[model samples]
Each structure stands twice: as C-alpha cells, then as structure tokens.
Target: MTTETMQADDYFYEFFDAVSNSTDISYVQKGDVLLCEKTEVNQFGARVLPTFYCINFILSLIGNGLVLCIIYKYEKLSTVTNIFLLNLVISDLLFAFSLPFWAVYHHSEWIFGSALCKLVGSLYSIGFNSSVLFLTLMTFDRYLAVVHAITATRSRKTMYAFASSAVIWFISILASVKDMVLFDVQPGNQSMMLCEMTGYHHNIMKKWQLIGHYQQFLLFFTVPLAMVLYCYIRISIRIMSTRMREKCRAVKLIFIIVLIFCVCWTPYNVVILLQAIEMSNGDQKQCSDTLDYALYMSRNFAYLYCCISPVFYTFLGKKFQTHFLKLLAKRIPCLNITIVTPTQSSKTTSFRTPNTVTEH
Candidate 1:
C-alpha cells in the first residue's frame, strides 16, 4: 500500500482510541482508483460534540465534586463501601477533568503538546477503568454485607478497603500504559495536529488497535459487568429470602447504579465489538460509515454515566439528602430548612445500619 492508502487505513483504526482525532472521510476503493467521500459527520461532530462534552464536563464536575465534599464533611470513610464510593467519585472527576481539553480538541485541533496528549489519553483510560473496578468492588461489598453479613465483617475493615483501593489504582495505571506510550501529537490533514497514535504502519496499528478494543471490552466492561450481575443477583436472592425492606432498598439503589452503568456503556461496547469483528475478518470497508456514526453517538451517550452516577449514589440516599440540607442550612443561615426526623416507616426502610452497606 502507498502512503495514502496507509493513512486511510490508519484513520479507520483511529476509532479504536478512546479519544479519536480523525475527521470525516470515507475511503472507498475501486479498481486502480481511490475515492475520498466527504460526509457530514465531521461538521456534525464539530458542531455538536464540543457543546455536549462541555455540558457533560460541567455536570460531572459539579455532581462529583458535591459528592466528594459531602463525603468529606458528613460521611465517615470507615466503611468499606464508603471508601469505594469515594474512589469512584474521584475517578469520575478525573475523567471529567479531561473533558474541556477534549471539547477544545474536537472543536479545533490539539494545541496541547505530546506530553499532555499522552497524559489526557491515559487519564481517559485510567479513569474509565477504575470507575468500573470501583463500582464492581462496591457491588461485591454490598453482596457480602447483605448475603454473608456475619462472615464478611472480618474482611470489610477500613484497612482492607484502603489496600484494595490502592491495588485498583495500580491496576488502572497499568491498564493505561498503552495510551501513555503510544499517544502523541501528530500532524493531520491541513496542518491540523491530532493527538493519536501515529508511528506504526497500517497493519501494525490495526493489530494494536484491535488489542485495545478487546482489552477494553473484556477488562473494562465484560468482566466487571459479569461480577456486578452476579453480586446483585445473589444480593437479590438474599433480600428476597430474608424479606428485609432495608436490604431491599439498599440493594435497589446499588442495583440502579449497576443498571445505569450497563445501559450507558453497553451500546458503545457493542459497536466496538462489531467493529472488532469487522476488522478481524478483514472487512473494514463494509459498514465503515455506519459504524463510524454509531461509534460517535454511542460513545457520547456513554459519557452520561459519570454525570448521572452522583445522583443515584449520593443525592438519592435519605441520609445524604438530610446531610446536604443540613449543610445548606448551615451555609445559608437565613434559609429556614428544617431537618425532618425519621418516621417509623422511614426507620423501617432505613438501610443505614452499622451492619448494612448503605449509599452515602
């Protein structure tokens, strides 16, 4: 293949990256002819994606930041689940912090240097991977708390929680090493510098890209999702058997978290899986445009997870609501916000016990 052919192939593989910098051009080949067809996708993306990313960034920042502040101010980090929730919020914030740069990149070009390019790419990888891992840990913690409440006490200590979180961070960093090593600022069409993997030939790049897609699909989504499903299923069974309203409510909140995670990420991963299959079978040109569009739409939709998590994880909790209202009242003394005492029904449904795993 000539240089032009290689560039076209590279652009196709660029979709494998979390933050792809490719513009909208579909390369179609005929006998002794190369056709470059321009689509509205790039223009559409430039107009829409930056604004969407900015909105997502602001919402995720405020939501996750509020959760962090509330956790620090009112909630104790003694519980294993609390530790996991704290780490999860931090991961979301880390992911959100890169959004403005991406918004700029999508709107224009990569003005940032190669170092920052790699850093942002790694942040994307690390934050996303760690969020899933921490969520899975939280689900398992709840599982142990609800299912084997007596036996799990020995293992659910704060020291163990910290150790587990440290290990998760280490794993997330290791998972992101590929982005750190490969991503760089490279010149694209019309002198636009793109932050993408640039040095490898088309075939080599495709191999690595496939590896990345599969790695993310398996490690980030598949395995963690499986664990979450199993934990939640067991928790549901335990709750059903015990008929404990408190456990049911606790499980319901965590279950919604897991459900939202799956809903947000599943479509993107499915698109990636289809793309991977197409690439592996040497059928990249078929449905290339369709997959490109699907990838963009689904990936943007997946970003909603970070923004939505704070609501389900913190604000929906009765305890968190009370704490937030109290904090608000303290901050604004003129506001007559009265803290309501727990009614009998509220007490019966309360999941905030020393032995239970509650959302904070």
Candidate 2:
C-alpha cells in the first residue's frame, strides 16, 4: 500500500491512453505515499480489462505456439540462434497462459480461486523477467556471432549459451515462488487482489519485493539493456564496414530482434520505475491523467510486441523464411516452383521464383 505502483483495481481507459502517449519526463511526484483505495467504476472506459487480457492471451497462444511448432517441426532450426527463440516463445507462452485468469479477475469478479490468483500473477512476473533476460541474451548471441566469428563457431560457446539459459530459468522459478505462495487477498476485494507485499510480515515482504524488483532490473532491464545497446552498436558498425555476403542474414536477424526489444518493453518499465520512486517519498499522490494515460498505452503496445515476435522471424530472419516459403509452395499444389542451376562463369548465381513470397 505504501510502495509505488498502481493498485490492482486501477481503471483501463486512462491507463491505455497514458501509455500510448508517454513523455520522457518522469511521472514521479516528490513526497508521495502510495495509499490509494479503489472506488466504484461508474461505467467509464470500454471495459478494457477483458479486452486487454483476451487479446494478449489469444495472440500469445497463436504466435508463440506457432514459433514452438516451427522449431520443433524442423530439425535444422534447432541451432544456437533458434535456441534463444525457443526460450523466448516459451517465456511468452508462460506469460500468456495466465491472461485468461486475469481477464476473468477483471471482467467477472475473481471467480477463479485464490490459488489461481497468486499463481497467475506470479507466473506473469516470471515470464516477463524471463522474456527480458532471453531477449537481451539473444542480442548478445547475435553480437558475438557477428563480432567474434571463431568464438561463436566453437562448441564450447554453444554449450555456454545453453548453460546460461538453464540458470536463467532456474532463477526465474525461484523468484516466482514467493508470489505464488505469499500473496494474500485483501479482505472483501473479490477478484481484485493481485500480487502485493502484505504488511502482516512487513519486514520480510518488503525485503522480498525489493529483491524481486532489483533482480528483475538486473536481469531484465539494466544490465541486459546495456548489453543489448552495446551489441547493436558493435553489430551496426560491423555490418556497415564489412562486405561479407554470408553475414548479411545474421545481421538482419539481429537488427529486427533489437528493434522489437526497444519497442515492446521500454515504456512499461519507465512507468513502473517512476511510480516506484514517487511512492518512496511519503505522499499518496494521485497519478496525473497524463501519467495514467501513458502507462496504459505502454501496456497494450507491450503485449503486441510479444505477440508479433514470431512474425519477425518470417520477415527478417532469412533462414526461417526460406524453409517456410518452400513449405507453403508445397502446401499450395497450384503454385509452381522454379529451380535454376548455377552458371559457374563467375562467383555469382541466379534463381527465378514464379511468384512474390509474402512474409508473415
């Protein structure tokens, strides 16, 4: 109650609007204690609770599920690069699976039991942290592949990547277990009770909550972001300077991944961080209409990024598209496939396709 964060029952209309049109300036007001109680929802906003959760659930299921299916179906796609993808899809699915429960908690009263309330909320946090960690790692992997060719090719490097993923998942689970067990539903709040640090064991709960936030920042926000930025800078420089034809595919893949990272996550964290700072001071400051609007806007756009991640593979990752197009051509019997052999006069080859391929 005293910490910085929007209460569980915060409204949606302003939330969406604020996030969509966010400002670079911090929303934190000095001398604010976060002790706001929920009031009646007097028929405002377009019932964003259900809409937000439903859209996120459906998108994550379809898109992340497809990514999983693609990797599992094709043996060749199980490379070092795609292993990171598999982690990403799995993280998205973990987050998405809990959306329906949240939607129910929002649309209908929290009819799903207390056990589910804690479980869903905890998993959501875990998935979010894992997603950030994996995306950052994936960027680093790409950066290494492009910048340090021999190291990337070594067997030990691949082993180390897998080892790192295992550690990330292990820590993510441990971080999540506390929420799953310790979250106490507020008295008489129906389904509105989400994960919170109860004052019952104030000292312990506060420590855990701060630890969780710090861990999330370390793995997800701060360190990973710095790594990603550095990697992208190095990668951009390498791509611009080098004339290596073979490296083009890898460069494009990394570029799209980096772009998605910036677009999806930057807004949500900014809101939370600023909110936290404001709450640390002792005033229960009401979120300005502008701040509320930006926070919600970021929430919607953030999930869209998660859902559209699989599509990035189709458009930007060259290897995925090649196999996918071939498969699509096979599925549509009416479509003709054209094959041309190399004319080895020079070091170049040419091929003609019968139709334009659409990237998913």
lDDT string for model 2 (1-360, tens) is 122333322244346457876643223223423443433231111267568778878877876765565567653433566666777778878888877776665554556666676777788878866776776666676666656767766852556768878988987787788777776455334334433444343334555655665565556677877887898778777765766465465456556666777777778767756654554553346544444556666767776666656555434543444545565667785777542322353212111110101111
Q: Write the per-residue lDDT of candidate 1 for residues 1-360, one digit (tens) a residue.
A: 001223244543454453644632233322343433423655666788889889989898878877788888988888775788888888888888888888898787899998899999889888878877877777677778767878987878999889989999999999888888888887776787888865665567688888888988998889988987888787777766764546667667656666677888899999989888887887637434677678778888778775656545555557777878988999998999999866776654454432233432
At residue 8, candidate 2 shows an lDDT of 29
| Candidate 2's TM-score | 0.73
What are the models' TM-scores? 0.84, 0.73
Compute the lDDT of residue 27 as modeled in candidate 2: 33
User: What lDDT does each candidate get?
Assistant: 0.73, 0.59
Worst 10 residues of 1 by lDDT: 1-10
Candidate 1, TM-score vs. the true structure? 0.84
Model 2 stretches astray by more than 4 angstroms: 1-46, 76-78, 155-158, 189-218, 245-259, 286-292, 313-315, 334-360
